[model samples]
Target: MPQTNGNAPGRCAPIPKTIPPMKDLTTENITENVIALNNLCSDPRTRYLFERLVHHLHDFARETQLTSEEWMSGINFLTAVGQISDDLRAEMILLSDTMGLSLLMDAIAHPRVPKATEGTVLGPFHTHDAPVTDNGYVLHDDPGAEQLFVLCNIKDTEEQPLENVQCDVWEGDSHGFYDVQKGADRQGPDGRAVLRSNSEGVFYFTAVVPVPYPIPDDGPVGGMLKLLNRHPNRPGHIHFMLETPGYDKLVTALYPRGDPYETSDPVFGVKESLIVDLSLVDEAVADKYGVKVGMKLLTYDFVLASDEQAAELRKDRRKEAAAKLDVDISTLHLD
Candidate 1:
């Protein structure tokens, strides 16, 4: 029934109309809504990143028809990962490493600098303020490990030795446990040390022959791996961080020639050029290098890129990134 207010003759108050059901939710509408909000961002990079992230995430969910339980389980898993992360162990990095994202990022950031050693992941094990030592210093005296001498030669693209280069080297013990993973009662450091290259760009050190070992997987990441039916093992390798003025800093690893897990390294840290075949040297030859008899010796050379070359490489990378995003190169230009 209609009621009249009598303000005007034959005037009646109109009945309120029913609101139509919200426009049927659809995949296209949902994606558009998420992307539209991205325009609110002031920074172009942030805006682009968010827009892509939202689109992909929404698409994944829509394509998978993700269930509520599955979404909640993922949230719980991430929360657990965060809960267990701390100073010594970073669960997020572990997750990324095991998933090979770390290596992918490294490849993107460092696009195989010409004549320079290809880089690898700087695993979660590196610590700052490492004890600095002179050439030919041994970091570990583990009786169980086979003594192996490392002779490193650092040079530029022109094959000339570079001076004042700091060669930081570290590895795990014979049992494949780093110093940080061992009990407090463990004595001395297990495969961690630093030395600087001499005027001839040569440095020497005695370290254990690195053994293939499983990454620390007792935590949430390990649990996730178990669920994914994947093994958490890295190949026998030694980490090297070479740094010097007027050159690109190199973070690389030297893999033993015959490591069983070389092809399946959990972190994907292996590089073909970085693999070395250790040679067994006789006492006479060993004495010349100050290494014990019946031990092995590994000789390797590292090449570094100049600052100008690195700058040019970066420009190319930016262009590639822009192409990948299907955006104008100027959009990524820095203010």
Candidate 2:
């Protein structure tokens, strides 16, 4: 049999005859030549993305006049980022969020719908197996933390109630620690739940008011943030993810209006339109949501986009992106 490689006792096969010769590399010609290496990629989307990526990378290296030492340092930092990440934590996502790329991609992919809800970044801590709970459920009841009741109303773009929508509610506790962040000995779900909307398109649950929390700062991303003179803290916000059969799934968070870090969330996840007005309630109002006499109440509404509407929006955004690259929209992948 003809050998394809040096597999048996140092016997080697000859090089393929079909390979093309590469031009001698220089700063001026390397970018185009590097892109040309992928000219045979079967996937159009991969080819399109990689061509632009290589162009920008070359430009960046030239613009900064990057040193070999600096490049090595970057490689070491990325290696550490991968080394320290496992099932529980996501250092890559942390790096992206701190650099604002995550939110930028989110904005491009989820361009605003005319009357539908807005979405923010899906942070790394979202868990899939949060316990299912009914409406009027109490998500938390810790004596050390002030009480909070969350009321959510779901509707369609035409203002029609959407029944049976899946709404996931999750947040860190008063101390800004999620259940998974607590490590292996955690007992059960803390400050998170899976819920379905009732017939009226409403769900009410008792939870503690989320406190502002810093993203994990012990990893490479944290060190990078410090070097950049930035803080890793995000504003106090409760996450909500809504899903239904015929509508676009919404992944969003509602930030309370008065958090100190609202103006400077490091991850760039907050939006002015998503900020909700929080109210302090007396015993009479608190009694309704089963909270303490002096607690907080948060009520927010959502409007979902239909599958067709969301698809159209995505197509339009891809067209805009393709236009910027001077590529045919038909050649660009929609998702």
Candidate 3:
């Protein structure tokens, strides 16, 4: 007979007398038994989440007829995900991303805000240590990178310029590698900066056109992608995080029009609205942005939604995230 007392080795507290003892669990009864005990979870939301999680997880095992070896393999895969994660690399986020869960959550959390910019995945490469620089900042120096000039103008939904906005920018080099990927944690920052928009609600930066690259795959998430026969390529793009008073912070990226990988970005970060056009600018235009002549000029304009509107839109999902997602939202790229 199974022990019902909390005193049993490695067991939880004794069941309350009001509830009957659990019978031996079978395949059909196991899910229900787990849920029954999970009802004791004090947080109403956590209880509901556990109920659903148990149902779907058990159902998956049953429907797939998952074997013991396969189950052990899954366990080992998760172990590797935990083992490889650190401050520099987040394997869990990568796993959620590879499985399309991150993008799905992004879609749910961030809905369209009239004419405002759309949000996308905050890929695993963003860093907080990017230095604040002047408007016409040079962010990279890769010999192989094609010269590019970037201009961003920020406005509110009503089309009025919003000055003093902080724009955090980052991108990969011609070879498709971020400074962090190049071991910058030891070498210090490159290819990223925090810029302030001027009176015209504009910020300028000199960069190399981003190129497609495989996400850091040498880990458990990569192995899972291989098993699923999926490609891990993301399209060439520039990431932007815009924040200013009384407006919702926008986390978004702009994909250049011609990347072949745009159609199949493994993380599903691409949307038609996020695609951008580039122009080869004259010397005068290049000088305005403080870069040398012949560099391609890419201009992207962004509109931000007010805080009031974003709060209303995000209330539903915020409740779930507040219910102990086991993550510090600040630490995760999705924030």
lDDT of each: 0.81, 0.84, 0.83
Q: Which ten residues in a row have the lowest lDDT in candidate 2?
A: 1-10
Residue lDDT tens for model 1, 1-335: 32333343466654334222234558778776656545556787787778778888998998899999999988998999899877666789888888889999888766777888888999988866467889888878688788788888899989999887988899888888888776455455557888999999898898889898899889888998889888888998889999988888888999989888989888888889989999876777577766777678888999988777776787788888889989977666522
- What C-alpha lDDT, on a 0 to 100 scale, does residue 11 get in candidate 3? 55
TM-score of each: 0.86, 0.91, 0.86
Model 2 per-residue lDDT at 277 = 91
lDDT of 2 by residue, 1-335 (tens): 22233333456665433334565799898987788666557787788889889999889999999999999999999999999998778989988887889999887767788988899988988888788988777776466987687878899989998888998988888888888787787687778888999899988788888889999998899999999999889998898899989888898999989899999999999998899998876787567656666568898889998988888989988888788978978667775
Question: Which residue pairs come into collision in candidate 3?
Answer: none
Better of 2 and 3 by lDDT: 2
> Candidate 1: where is the Cα deviation over 4 Å?
1-26, 183-189, 282-288, 330-335
Q: What is the lDDT of residue 156 in candidate 1?
A: 94
Model 3, 1-335: lDDT tens digits are 34444543565666553433577889999999889778767776577778779999999999999999999999999999999888778889988887789888877767777898999988888999998999888888787778788888899988999999999999987888887775535487788999999999988888888889999988888888888898889999999999988998898999999898989998889999999999877878766765667679888889999988776666645556645665443322233
